[model samples]
Target: MSDQPPSHGTPYPYAYGPPSYAAPPPFRIPDAFGWSWDMLRVHLKVLLAAMIPTVVVGLVLYAMYFWRLVPIWIDMAEPTTSSTVQLDRFQDLWATVGLLYAAALVVAIPLSLFHGNLVRMCLLIADGGTPSYRMILSTRRAGRVMVTTAVLLVAGVLGTILCLLPGIAFAAFSMFTLPLLLDRDLGTFAAIRGSFALVRAHLGLCLLTFGLLIAVAYAGTMLCFVGIAASMPLGTLILVYAYRSLQVTGRTV
Candidate 1:
């Protein structure tokens, strides 16, 4: 195939077999990050497609969390007839919340990495190639990235406590460590180095991608956090697609 899009303007490239279902095309990551508004307008449909499942899952998880709070609310709403019982309830609530938060890492940390790879896969499919969920699933098969995620998750929290700089910088620049590690089957230092290499020359694009993500995330939160379940996949797919595009083009991604 030619370096650019196919000679004909058909969006997809290969002659492939049936996908999961012949329903509609799955989501695609964009060719790269620095797309023109014109191009984005053209591909907005795929971006939306990439995001659907993410939003549904996020909404369901949120609903479950929200329901968990209902019992606490009911308890408080009941006449506080006794400060003793109220205090006991509050303690129990805190204990449960703490346990849940601690336990969540086992799930959340890995899911975080999966989410990143999923966006990358979307980009791959967008390039008129097959996107393999197995590619992403393979990344999680070993526990290395999972451990890194837990570390990063804590590092991220600690960074927040120390100063916003650490957190912000990690979010933008080092965000790819997990993806690099998983996709390339690299070690921690290697993944870190690879991520740095990937964005070394394109700091501006990386920062811009991060800025866009923050903007979208902010917008989603303002929408009663529906945006989280709503916007994350969409936001993430575009950014990942753009990044991969830049890298594959042998330009400073």
Candidate 2:
């Protein structure tokens, strides 16, 4: 009777808290790959434009290796007239190798600065936003991206020297570092940590994505090496799409 009488004032049992909503499930492998391909198809032009720097740098590096490194190796292999001459030639060979490496870094470091811009463009396209070539070319986070890349390269090389597994693990953990750095404006270490966390949380999915991308790139290579121009950008778009889906679902590392 008292409850009925109090009906106008409030419910018989007052609500204690806000209603809860269930979280969405993690992205399945098929869904992730499908979405990535769809996004790539939609933004094909912009994605291909983004790959220009990568392609150019790759060509330059290849040319340098073929022209400079090959001659050095050939000269080093040939017989020399005397011990002193051999020693001098060996020193010259080392000097040439060092110079070639330095030259590569000089060219590659600047070109790699564009990677952040490319990732940003991919993310923008994934979010249904149309980004212009001029806008995509603006690399505000180039310095940070370059530094992070150098760190990862050193870490990967050191890990590889120690054991191959650690190198693979480092690469897997860093799959999202560039995107995280660009999107979040995070410091290098923070972005790296975030990427590691994301990968650690979804290790199997990350591995699948990574392996599939490598396979795609390899296929591109097999097709007279011209396929890389298309495959590389497509792979990048796929990664951006996967990252977008994870972010949307609030699946942080």
Candidate 3:
């Protein structure tokens, strides 16, 4: 062994936390390069683990709604009813179920966000960047993003109820909200408002980028679920970049 003292140094000199950068790039996420399959696969184990909580939350919400509402009206919903009773049954079927389901979903969105952020955090870590679950949790401004998200969700559901076409369009428009919210220090409302403004500002580009995502999703659905599990991550990563580009610079469609 050499008689030289090994120089002791911090793992990441001039940086904090792990040797990983752990923070987003200062400016913008690069186009077509923000995310990749290789990067995503490195994080799949994390994603799979995160999904357990999400699945559990979903099942809980479903169970809550089913148990709470089904017994209430199912007993009242007799098949052999007179014409007037049939009309009442129809009214209860459509309208009452609608209200109950809406209430159930209101409870579910935050749970879903929690799950999504879990995945997002893992992605950041796996991408060779150091980030924290604490920072991720702190990103939410409570009132801002949550309320905006809830409003938009209601609006989207309403749009879908109006017609399938508008629903598809609305869903497409909503593609970037998650990354935008997470990557920025945006309150819930600001993030949502910014998302809408960005989409409208670059309507064509937003539509096109998200359109490709839709096409991919459609193809994935057609090929059975394997395609979706593999492909969804890539598409989601694309959103991270796309949202960063739209917000960081006033790039037009």
Candidate 4:
């Protein structure tokens, strides 16, 4: 498929055909969820391997924060501490907190890169194409993926701050940015635009799929947060499946 967008009056490569008088097929949420679970079960080992770095990084950060805060809490709790000393310690603690946050964001860059590649791997699996570990970890398009992710994060944050509804709208619209960037090798902005166009073209279907996946993820979070180990990968598979469905039916722009 060409990376270039179709010109005015031209048909999109993945455009759906004209509709018939009959009703369209319904979005089967249960089937999609089941398919996600099946894919996760088949590739459980690979998915866990891919998630190791992220899980380790998170644990390390959490431990560091806990260790660092315990002493501060003890110091604050001491009635004998001088006001000046307490203020000085508090400033130091705040500075340390800022540094930790900066460090986390830096770590997140590579994590996002790996995640984008993992999404592509899932897409390949969904399409019946075998993808190797080396290919999945390859950095061929890491730059584009990282840039697109940063843009999405900023936009999503700004939209959420502006209004709750626009934030949800932006999140729903840009759901396919990573997949499009990986598969089409499009520029960051181009991929973002393509995601919006595609989701807009199939708004209702996209909304239902995205919402269901979000609901599943939320449910996982409620389960002492351990369920995310299963739900997160399942959500990714469902997304890749949905993307493939749209691609196969020429429903994506």
Model 2 TM-score relative to the real fold: 0.74
Per-residue lDDT of candidate 2, residues 1-253 (tens digit): 0100001122244377754445554666666556666666766787777777767777776676668767767877888878997888778777877787767655656666776777787777666687678855786877888888788877876787687989988888898998888888999899999999888877787889889878878988776556777786667766776676566455675
Q: What is the C-alpha RMSD, rounded to one decimal, of candidate 1?
A: 10.4
* Per-residue accuracy of model 3 over 155-200 as CA lDDT, tens digit each: 7788888877787777776666655566566665565666777788
Candidate 4, 1-253: lDDT as tens digits = 1111111233335547864343323445666677677777777877767766666676788778778888887877777548798788889789878788767766777788778877877877776665576754778788877878778877876787796778788989999888888888889889889888888887888899889879978986676555666677778878876776665445667
The Cα RMSD of model 2 versus the native structure comes to 10.2
For each candidate in turn, the TM-score is 0.59, 0.74, 0.58, 0.73
lDDT by residue (132-241, candidate 1, tens digit) is 43554445435776666677778776786677888777666666675566556778767766777776766776777677777777888787566564456546555555
Q: Please give the lDDT score for candidate 3.
A: 0.57
- Model 1 alpha-carbon miss at residue 52, Å: 8.3
Give the lowest summed-lDDT range of ten residues in model 2: 1-10
Best by TM-score: 2
Pairs that collide in candidate 3 are 22-130, 144-188, 144-189, 145-188
lDDT winner between candidates 2 and 4: 4
The segments of candidate 3 whose C-alpha lies over 4 angstroms from its true place after superposition are: 1-36, 61-82, 112-116, 119-127, 130-143, 158-171, 212-235, 245-253
- Candidate 1: worst 10 consecutive residues by lDDT? 1-10
Per-model tally of clashing residue pairs: 4, 0, 4, 0
Write down the lDDT that model 4 would get: 0.74
- Which stretches of model 1 miss by more than 4 angstroms? 1-61, 67-100, 132-142, 197-200, 220-230, 245-253
The lDDT per prediction is 0.58, 0.72, 0.57, 0.74
